[model samples]
Every structure is written in structure tokens, then in C-alpha cells.
Target chain A: MLKVEVDRTQCQNFGQCVVEAPNVFRLNSRDEMEYTPDVEDAELDNVEAAVDVCPMQAISLALGR
Target chain B: MSPPVVIVGASLGGLRSAEALRRCGYAGPITVFGDEPHAPYNRPPLSKDVLGGEVTHAAVAFPQRAATSDVEWRLGTRIRSADLEQRSIRTTDGEEVRYRALVVATGLRPKRLSPRTATLAGAFALRTLDDAAALRNALHPGVQVVIAGSGFVGCEVAATARQLGCEVTVVGSAELPMLGPLGSALAEDVMRRHVERGVRFRMGTHVAEALGQEAVEGVRLADGSEVACQVLVEAIGSLHNTEWLDGNDVNAAQGLRTDSAMRVLRADGSSWRDVFAVGDVARFPNAIYGDEPASIEHWNIPTETAKRASRILALQLAEDPRLDAAIAERFAPVPSFWSDQYDMSLLAYGLPALADRVELLAGKAGGDCVYGYFVGDRMVGVCGIGMRSEVLKHRDEVSRYGHVPIGEPAR
Candidate 1:
């Protein structure tokens, strides 16, 4: 398992992550970012894409959740 | 020791390319060369935050990942030319580097107002961090700033200058500012918003001459009118940094023409397997827009193209079984761009400018609204100001558009 973290302080809710990896990240009705903290190892590619597109550079992924 | 993969231009594209190479399982040596003195830094903020506030390299520098730590970085080294047939590149200082693979990530330089190439002290063009830093000092309260061009940079800088209490007057060639990208309606709204914020515009004209003795004092518009300015900012456009590729047989007339796989193509339409391009430099075909190749200089393009190019390069380097099959799945990256001017947060998916007509999709015309861009019957793009959620819903439609079955010709 890989652990995903988003620094809300830096996040502007650009929703780029939601476009890249919709399964793990989403924008709520208020347009606030809601994301899955833990992701399966198989979701690395998608999660990594999400990290790259985050203009704020807020998303982070690590091994061994 | 074998020759390493050499990537030119050390900005967002170069950094992303190096990182993607590692991600795609290429363990070999990678070297990136850049003309700028500083390491890779984000550029989007240069016109907004950095321009409005204190400008520094640290504030906008992209975070370096551990995976690409071993990648050699040669900053402030200008490559004079490259011989693709010889598989070698010569630096301006007479240094030669034989690269196993070359990634042409050299992006663009801002185009200045012609007829006057002199380096006036107060005159600036906001492309590099240095440009922003220099322009920052002249942007204090009550300074009369004349910005040439009405593109994103021009408008953004106008807004930022207004925020800093500078008197900004934007001179544009088009009837309305940002007419090429944003349609008339949204542009009117944007212009209205800017006007509300006290930013003036001189539409349907261009800066013919920068009038000054030493530092820029004013500009003479092509309309035969003169506006006194304390600072002059030329945000006209950009020229591709492809001059170093002079002797090469590559089609760099526009940007380097590339196949959908990111391989640099020759004038005869043959692609060089080892030479690829990414970011604003690579004019690759987008599936949503059919087979027409274009160089989209959006913020997301660097990371997107770098990842695709790295995947293919890594596979080729490793001699993977997947290499035999021509990339059947065409590179289908959904184009995206965003901008901030005053209180408006502009978000867009796909090339909205490519559309012939734009229709109201959701929300009111004057306020937060979504507009769907259409070509014929298919909705090609979606753009809106403020309605983030509503606008994003059509992202899939834009991605799936133009299924007209147009791609690389049979070759």
C-alpha cells in the first residue's frame, strides 16, 4: 500500500488531481478537494500523475502506509 | 562509460523528462543543459505572484525529486549547435558532448517589440525569473506602465501591476484583449473586470516604437498616438529556442515537428528514434483535434509530453517487446490551462480557440459561467470563469471529441 498526503494549506483545489486520478481524488459540492489517503500499489501510475498535475505541488505519495 | 541521454533546456520540461526517464525504468546516466543560471523553476507565477510580490527563484522553483538526484545538471551552458547525424552537440564554449539520446526541451524566449532592440533599463519582457525580478522593482505605486501585446502574459501582468498600484495600459493588436484564446464574450467579461479594477486598454493597435532616451519613457502606438510610460513591458509572444539546431535536417521552421509518439520528425516526415522533443518545443499531433500537429505552450504540456516521451524512450533503451508494435494507442493528452486575473479564476480543458463557435453551457453570461466550444457537431472544449465544478464535468466530452478518425497519414 502507498500512503497519499495532500497539504491543504498549499492546495487551491485546482481539481487537476480529480481529472488525473478520479478514483482516489475528487472535488466535493463545495469544490473542495477530497482524496483517498491510502491507495493500492497498483494505483501508483495514476497517483503519480495526480501528483505531477497538482499546480500547488501539495500531493505526496510514500510507500508502506 | 557510455554516452548519456542529453536533454537541452533546464526548465519544467527538462526536469520532468529526467524524472520521467527514471520512472519509466531507465537507469542510465541522464544530463540536462540549461542556459539559465538557476536550476529548474516554475514559470506560471512569474507573471502573477512573483510579479505582484517579491520575486525570487526559491519561491517558484519546482521541488526536486529523489529519483532524479543523480541526473547531471549543466546550468548556464549554452549549446551552440547539434549534428544529429554525428550524434553530438557543441556548446558555445567549444565543448562537445556525444549524447546517446537527445531530448530537445529548449522551450521559448519572449519576443520583443521590433525596430528597437536596444536594452532599455525600464523596458522588460516577462519570460524568465530575471525578467520578473527586473520588472518587479518598477511596479511600485503610481508608476505608469505600458505593456505591449494582449496575450495571457500581457493581461496577467496588467492585472498584477494594477494590484501593485501601478497605472497599467495594455496595448494589443486585436480588437479585444485575448481574442485568440478567449472568445469575444468571455474576453468582454475579462475586459470589463479589468476595467473595473482600473486597468486601461489600447485595443486594435501595437507598439510601433519605444520612446525613450535611456530607460523607456513612453511608447508610440501604430495608431499614431503616444502614451507616456515609466516602464515598457513587451509581452507580444515567443520565438522557439531552436536556433542551436541550425545545421540539423530537422523541421524547426515552427517548432520541431514530432510524431504522436514524441519522436522528432524530419522534413520528409521520417521520425528520428533517438531525438525527441517535449513541452512547448514539440509540435505533436493531438487525437482530440485530429491529425493536425500543434505546439501547445500550456503549463500541463511539459509534464504530459515528458512522461509520454520517457515511456517510449525507456522501452526503446531496454529493447522491450512492446517496442516492436507501433504505438497503436495514439498520444491523447487532454489539453488544459488555467489563469488568474483579479477575482476571476479561469480554468479550461482542451483548445477552446480551435472552435469556430462557443455557446453558453451553464451559468449566467456576466457571472460565473461555463461555455462549451464546438466545431461542427462535436463539443471540442470547455472553458469558464469561477464555475470550477460545472466546467470540469465536460472534460471527458472534450477528451473524447473529434473521433473523425484523422491521425498520422499511412506511412
Candidate 2:
């Protein structure tokens, strides 16, 4: 399992992360990015893409023990 | 032991660096320091929707899932000293934090009018959210607003004020607005557009002083003309936040000099292994452009540079092949930016400042069209105004390693 996080203080909600991982991340009604923190191992590829596509570089993932 | 990553400046660049570090699978402790109290919010909308009263301050908050990653957010604080040799930073609160890797993203601050003028009740300049909010409150119907500059920020504010039914006048020393970037031909079109929207332009006029006893009442120009207004919004350019690095060997000036990989360069033009810089605070060379170090004040470079910095940090920690050469090439992505003014949406691909020639590819002057700029024979940049589809198409072509054909198309 992987845990994804974003620094709310730094993100500008440009939605570049959503384009990288649509399932794990999304832009809320306020036009800010909303996402689930935990993702299945199978979705690692998309999550990694989210990590790259984020314009504000506002996403992070941690491998569980 | 994995060293803690210290990020200075909680703006887009620093914030993105922290996020990129997590994305790169660094589970080590991360700390972010910001000078402002509020959480990171989108600034583009501040001059638009927020000023137009279409959105509230809370509405601009960038969304993040609560469990994204555990990060130590030190808000309302700033890094007073960065000791690169010791890899430590001292904050304004007297706390010292050591880092294995540091990302400096301290963005620029707006150049203000003299303190005497700024101390006036209604004088304003928009750089942060608070600045925007204050400027927003002063925009009411029939409020005479005198904008000091006609650059991107000034033009945007003028449009917003016009939308709010405020009497707006833009004062600048340029023959045409934005001649420094878009050149005379295009700047003239921009000036025409604003003029058609009821904005008065005082070209070649310099401000002698802002006239007011307690509050902003008018502006005295060099030509001995007084333009009266209730609000004075100065949209002059910005000064990069690099003064804190004084006395350090780091090549610091208007911005920190960096390479393609976003590594901060030393005085002798050597990259600092553990020190990286990004955003408006970094001045670096563009691979596509010439060797001149280009410093973009746009929103895209910071986010892009942060990701590149994160990759380098991860590789260094992992002890991967010290392939700095390969990594630098992969990190140098094309520069792109956009801005929205009134009903027109402008998108620019690549860096136009490096271009030698510009041609109107599809649209009329100021109409819906894609304008292509080139450096020698290569298509370096494209600017689109009201031509979103064409812009996207050309953007895709440019991104795919394509170029604009040598001569004019068979129109």
C-alpha cells in the first residue's frame, strides 16, 4: 500500500496533478485538488504519474511497512 | 541517516519541492517555512475572480487530502539565514534546522512606491492574497483608480477595475504598454484593447509623486498634469527575494543562479551539491534559448523546477549513477505560461524573449489567432489571444519536437 499526501500550504490547485492520476486525485468544487490518501498497490503507476504531473509539485507518496 | 530536507519559502516553488520529494519516495522528515500566515492559495485568481468579487478568500484555498503526507508546516515565519556550508537554516523564531538538501523558493515581492506615498490611506499594490483583498475593497463603482504601471499586473488590475465600474487610468513611461516583452506592434494592440474598454492611457508620462495629505487623492506626472483618483494601485515590477543570501558565496543578485537541473550555482559557476533554487527566485539558462540566464516570473517555472530538484535529491540519496549530465537534460523542459485579461485568454509556449522573429500565423491583430515566434529557423514560442484551440494544437506540435515551417504558410 502507498500513502499519498499534499502540502496544503504550498499547493495552488492548478489541477496538473489530476491529469496525472485521475483516480487518486481530483479538483474539488472550489477548483482546488482533492485526492484519496491511500491507494492500492496496483495503482502505483498512476500515482507516480500524479507525482510527476503536479505543476506545484504538491503530492507525495509513502510506502507502508 | 537520511538528512532532513529544508524548504524555504512556502510559495509555489518551495511547496512543489516538498511535494515532489514525497512523490520521489523520500519518507524522511520534511519541513516548510513560509513568511505568510495563511495556507498556500492560488494567486492567479486573486487579481481576477477575487478582485471581481466572484469568489471569496476561502474559495481560493488549494485543496489537499488530509492524509497526503505528514509535513511540518511552519507558517508565518521566514528563514533568516541559510548556512549552506553547515546545511542549516535559522528561522526568525530562533529555531535552527539542519538539512541534507535545501530548496530555496523565496518568490519575488512587488516594488512599492515611496513609503510616503504608500503610507497614504488608499495606496495599494497586489502581490499576496492580503494585498489582493485590500485592493478588492477599494474597487467600487465610480472610484477613480490610477494604476502606476501597464505591465501584466497593471493591465489585469485595470481590466478588473473597469469590470467593477471604476474609472481606470494607466500611467506609464513606455511609448506602448509591455514593449519590453511583446514589442511595439503587439503592445500597441494591447493598449488599443484597453482603450476600447474605457481605460485612459497616459503614455510617456512618469509619476513625479502621488498626491494626498492622508489618503490617495491624485497623482502628479512629470508633465505637470494631475490625475485625480481615490485609489493608487502601483503595478510596478518585482524584486526577487535573494537579499538574505548576502555575504554567502552563492551567486546571488536579482535571483539565485541555477543550472538546467535547478542546482544553485556558486560564484565560480559551479553547482552546489546540496543547495537548489526554484521559482521566481531562480535565474537559469534555457536549453532551447541561448546561453543567457532567463528568469521567468510566471507560475509554471517554479513548479517545474521543483520537480526537477526533487529528482536530483532522490537520486543523490539513493546513490544512483552520478549521471548529472543525463539528469540535467531530462529536467530541462520547455517553458510555457498563460494569463487571462478581460475576455481574452493568452497562452505562451516556449520563451519569446529568446526569439529573433515573430509572425502572425492564424489570427488578426488582437483577434482570435495564434502568433508564432522563432529563434532563427526553430519555433521558439507561440502566443494565443482568444484562440484556444489553435494555441493548443500548436502547443502539442511544439511539444512533440515539431517546428514552424521556414517561410509563411500557403495562406
Candidate 3:
């Protein structure tokens, strides 16, 4: 599993991450950004992609604890 | 030891290129040259947040990756020129570096008018962190500010300056700001928003001369009008930084002309497989837009082009059988750009400027709305304010629109 972190203050809820990693990140009813804390190892590419697409540069991923 | 793949321009594109090369199983050495002393940092906020608050390089710099930890970063080293035939570049500090392959990602420098017309002290152009920091210091409450070119950066800075309590005025040669890209309908809404926030617009005219002795006191417009302001910002446009490739025989005058594979071309239209360009400096054809090659300066282009370039270039370097197949893959990157002016966040996909016709798809003209940009009957792009989901949905549709594929798909 991989750990995902998003700086809420920096994130503008662009939802670009939602488009790239649909299985991990999402937008709530209010349109604010939300994401899974842990993702499968197979999702590393998708997760990295989500990190890249974030206009705020607020997303990061690391190995799960 | 084999020469490293040297990537010029140590910004997002250079960093992404290095990472993509490693991902493609290229075990060779990599070197990235950047003129800035600081490492790669996101530049979007330079026109927004950094102008409102503190300016720190560490706050915005890209996180260090273990994969590229070994990659040599020649920061603070400016390349004077490149010798394409010799496969080497010389730095301004009298250092020569050779590379087996080169990635041109030098990007651009903001085109300035005050340098010749007015003093540099109170003039600004926001492209780097330093520019933002300097501009931030000058943006005091109730200070008169004049911005040239009411484009993306100009309108953005106008918004930021207003937030800082600066009396802001944007000089534009169009009836509305962002009229070229957003079109008149959406652009009028944007201008209205700016006007509501106390930002003034001087439309259908541009700054002819910035007048001052010690610093910019005001500007004389080409229409024989004058606006007095203490601070002047020229966000007119950007000039290509392709001068370093001067004697290279490549058609870099417009931009570093490249094929769909990112291979740079000679003036005679022959491509140099070893030299590639990504980001704002590269001009490549988007079949979705037509066969006419253009340099799309959208923020997403650097990442997309670098990844594609590195993927194919890695295969070629490794002599992998997959090289030809990789080159044959269809690369139709949907250009995306966004602007955060106050509470109104404008997001778009595809090239809106390429459209001859625009139709309102959703919402009110004065409020949150989505616009479909069309070239004749075919939809070419989409732009919206506050309708993120609706706007994003059109990305695929526009990307698939008129995709005259130059090569066979990998599948």
C-alpha cells in the first residue's frame, strides 16, 4: 500500500486528481477534494499521475506505514 | 562512461524528464541544468498567492524524489550557447558540458516594455519567484498600479494587486480582457468581476511609453492617453529563449520546431533524433487543432511533453525493439489551463483560441457557466467558470475531435 497526503490549505479542489486516480481521490457533495489514505501498490502509477495533475501541487505519496 | 542526457531548463519539465527517463528503464546518467539558484518550484502561484503573502522558495519547490537523487543538478549555471553538431553546450561561467542527448526546456522570459521606456525600479514582470517577491514588496495599500496587456498574467496580477489594496488598472488592446482565449462572452463576465472588485480596465489601447525618471510614474498609451501610476507591470507576452541554439541549423526562431515524437527539426524539415524539446519552447502540431504546429504554453504541456519525449527517447537510447512502436503511438495531449482570480476560478481544456465559434453549454453568462468552443461544426475546446466537472467532461470529446493521426496507435 502507498500513503497519500493532500495539503487541504493548498488544494483548490480542482478534482484533476479525481480524473487521474478515480479509485483513490474524489470530490464530495460540496465539491471539495477528498482522497483515500492508503492505496494498493498497483496504483502507484495512477497515484503519481494524480500528484502531477494537481494544479496546486498539494498531493504527495509515500510508502504506507 | 557514457555522456549523460543533459536537460536544459531546471523547471518542472526538466525534473519530469529525468523522472520519466528512469521509469523507462534507462540506467544511464542524467544531468539537469538550471539557471536559477533554487531548485524547481511551481510557478502558477507566482501571480496569485505569492503576491498576497510570503515568498519562500522552499514552500513551492517540488519534493525531492529518491529516484532522481543521483541526478546531477547544475543550478545557477546559465548556458551561453549550444553547439548542436558537436553535441555540447558552453555555460556563461566558462564551463563546457557534453551530452549524448539534449532536452530543450529553457521556457521563456517575459517580454518587457519599461526597460526601454521607464526605469526598472518600480517595473515588474512575474515569471520567476524573484519577480513575485519584488512585486509583492511594492504592492502596498492604495498605491497606483498600471499593468500592460490584460492577458492571463496581467489580469491575474491585477486581481492579486487589488487583493493587496493596490489601486489597479489593466491596459488591454481588446474590448475585454482574455478576449482572445475566453472569447467576448466569458471575457465580459471576467471583466465585470474585476470591475466589481474595484479593478479598472483601459480597453482597446496599450502602453506606448512608460514615463518616469527614477521609477515608472505613469504610462502614455498609443491612443494619446495617459494613466498615472507608481508601479508598472508588463505582462504583454513572452519571447522565445531559443537564442542559445542560434547556429544549430534548427528552425527555433518561432520555437524549437519538433515532430509529434518531440524530435527537433532542421530548417529543411529533417528531424534530429538526438535533440528534443518540451514545454513552452517547443512547437509541435496538434492534429486535433490541425497540421499547423504551435507552441501551447499551457501548464500541463511540460509534464505531458516531457513524459512522452523521455519515454520514446529512452527506448531509442537503449536500442530497445519497442522504440519504433513507441514512436508510432498517438500523442494527443488535451491542453489545460486555469486561472484563480479572486473567488472565480476559470478552468479550461483544449485550445479555446483555435475556435471560430463558441456556444454557451451551461449556466448563466454572469455567473458559473461552461462554453463549448467549436471550429466550424466540430467542437474544439471547452472553458468554464465554477463548472469543473462539466468542463472536464469535454476534454476527451475535444481531444478526439479531428484527431488526424500521423502515426499508428500502439494498440
Candidate 4:
């Protein structure tokens, strides 16, 4: 499993991450971001892409035991 | 043994290049030089949160994703001169550093008004972290602030000043603020938003002179009208920081022109194989835009260009025979930039300057909307005001690499 974290304080809800990894991240109706805290390990690459494209660099990922 | 790869500027571009070099499996020593005494920090917030006093001084720091322990950091050291033939740069402290590969990311310096006006006590410009801190300190309630130029920096500063309860009066040479970049309709919308926020505008005019003999008491317009101000910020524009390349064949007056691969081009139009220019300092001919040479000053350009430069450097460091051929290859990443003012977050993809026609794609023009700029039948740029998802869809459609080019002619 992959554990994801987003620093909401730094996030401006640019939604670049959602476009890169839609399965892991999504924006609410208010245009704010909401993402899955944990996801399948196979989705690591997609999550990593999100990390790179996040405008605010607010996304962080950790691998689960 | 190969000489270490040396990166100048030590900001976003420099740091990202170092990290990308490591990711590319380059085992060589890496060194970064910065004129500023502090570590690399995020610059986009300098005019927003940093100037708004909404975030702490440390809040604006860019995440140091690049490991610093292995990299040699020469902070507060400015480069004075460069010798392209010798492949070395001399620092202001009289130190010469030779490198196997050089990455120039010196970026830009804010353009100030005349020395006479800029030297005034209350006159300022926000570029560096120190500049933002100083400007934030002056944003007391009811402080009359006069900002020259209606560019992103000036408008952002005005919005921030209003948030801090300061009275702001923006003076610009355009009839509507941000008309050059945001288009007249959206610019008028932004201007109206500012007016609704109680910020004043003196449009279609230029600042004739800085009022007050000691401090900036106000600004005298070309029409002989004076706007009272306790503080003055000249957010006019920026000049590329290329003075260190003074004697080099590259054009320092404009920007250091680079070939498709971001290699610095000499006056003879030959590529400097081991030397590359990244970030705002690099003026490269973009392949997507039909090889039009432009210097993009957006925040993301540095990161994207740095990655490309690192990939090329890595391939070269590995003694790959393809390095020579790769040097001539084109790197055309879809350019993007964003600006935040009050509640509006303007996002743009592709180059708006390349468009001849613009159409409203989704939503209303003044409200949350996406505007698409086209060159004939092809979408060249897409911009939005508070429209995130709609802009993303356009971004995907406009990008050459993103889900089939929207209007590519059959080859």
C-alpha cells in the first residue's frame, strides 16, 4: 500500500495532481482537493507523477509495511 | 577524473538540476553557487503571502527535495566573470572554479526606476525574500501605498495591501490593468474586482516623477496629477541577470540565447557543448512554437528546463556516443504559469503570445471561465480565471504530448 499526504496549508487546489493521478486524487465541488490516504502499491508510479506535477509541491507519499 | 558539475544561482532551477542529475545516475560531484546568503526559497509567494503578512518568513521555503549533504554549497558568493574557452568562472572573491559541465540559472533581477527615485526611503520592489519581508513590514493599516505598473507583481501587491487594510493606488500605462497578458475583458474584470476591494487605479498614464524630496510621499503622473502615498513600489518589470557573461559571445542585454537543447550559443552560432542555460536566463527557440525564440519567466520553466538539461548532462557524463546527436534534439514542454490575486487564481497553459484569435471555451468571460487562444484552427493557448477543471481539460487538449494534438494537420 502507498500512504499519501497533502499539506493543505500549502495547497492552492491547482488540481495538477488530480490530472496526473485521478485514481488517487480528486477535487471537490468547491474546487478544493481531496485524495485517498492509502492506495494499492501498484499505483505508486501514478502517485509519484502527482508528486512531481503538484504546483505547490504539497503531496507526499510513503510506502506501507 | 572528470571535473565536478557546477550550477550557478542555487535557486529553483539550480537545485532542481542538481537533483535531476542525481536521478539520471550521474555520480560526479555537484556544486551550487548562490549570491544570496540564504538557502533556495520559493519566489512566487514573495508578492502574495510573504507580502500579505499571511505566512511566516520560513513559510515560503521550497521543499529541499534535493539532498544537500553531498552537494558543495557556495552561498553568498557572486560570479564576476566567465571564460567560455577556459571552461571556468571567476567569483567576485577572486576564486576561479573549473567545471566539466556548467548550468547557468542566474534568473532575473527586478527592474527599478531611476536611482534618484529608487533611493527614496519608502521606495521598494519585491523580488527576493528580504524584499518581501521589508515590504510586508510597511503594510500597516491605512498606509497609503502607490504601486507603479499594473503587471502581476503590481496587481498582486495591490491585492495584498488591501488585505492588510492598506489603501492602494495602482498606476499603469494601460487603459485596463493586465490587459497585455489577461486580455481586455478579463483585465477589466480583475480591475473591477480591485475597485470593489477599494483599491484605486490611475490607468492610461505613466509616473512622471516620484514625489517628495526625502521619501516617496506620492507619485506625479504624466498629466501632472499627484496620488498621495506613504510607500511606493516600482513593479515595472525585470531584467535578466546576465552581467556575469558580459564578455561572452552570448547576448547579455536581452538574454543568453540557447539552441533547442538549452546549450548556450556563441556569437558564431555554435553550441557550447558542456555549458547550458536554464530558467529565466535562457532564451531558447521552442520547437512547438515553430522555433520562435523566447525567454519564459514563469515559475515552472526553471524546473522543466533543469530536468532537460540534467538528462543531457547525464547522457554526456556517461560517455554515451549519442550525446553529440542528442545535443541537437528539441525539448518542447508545454509552457504553463499561474497567478493569484485575492480570490481569483488565473492559470494559463501554452504560450498566449503565440495566439492570433481567442474564444470563450467554457463558462462566462468575467466570472469563472476558460479562454482558448487559437492560431487558425489549432488551439495554441488556454487560460482561465477560477476555472480549474475546465482549464485542465484544455491543457490536455492543447498540449502536443497530451492525448493527441487538438488540431494537428495530417502528416
Q: Candidate 3 residues B1-411, lDDT tens each?
A: 989999999998898999989988887899999999989999988898877889899767898888888999999999999998999999998889999999999998888884564336788888998888888999999999999999999999999999999999999998899998898898999999999999999999999988887778999999998999999999988877899998888997667899888989999998898999998888887666556577888888899999999999999998999889988777778788899999999888877776779999998888889999887777777999987777877878878837433231100
Q: Order of candidates by DockQ, top first? A: 1, 3, 4, 2
DockQ for model 3? 0.59
Off by over 4 Å in 4: A19-23, A27-32, A39-49, A63-65, B54-57, B66-68, B322-329, B401-411
Better of 1 and 2 by lDDT: 1
- The interface RMSD for candidate 1 is 1.0
What TM-score number comes out for model 2?
A: 0.83
Assess the local accuracy of residue B398 in candidate 2 as a C-alpha lDDT between 0 and 100.
46
- Show where candidate 1 strays beyond 4 Å: B115-118, B401-411
DockQ of 4: 0.51
Clashing pairs in 2: A4-B68, A5-B68, A5-B69
Q: Please give the lDDT score at residue B243 for candidate 2.
A: 76
Q: Estimate the TM-score of every prediction.
A: 0.96, 0.83, 0.96, 0.92
RMSD of 2: 6.5
Task: Report, for all candidates in order, the number of backbone clashes.
Answer: 0, 3, 0, 0
iRMS of each prediction in angstroms? 1.0, 6.6, 1.4, 1.9
lDDT of 2 by residue, B14-111 (tens): 77788777777777888888998876766777776578875464756555533335878888998888788888888877888899888898888888
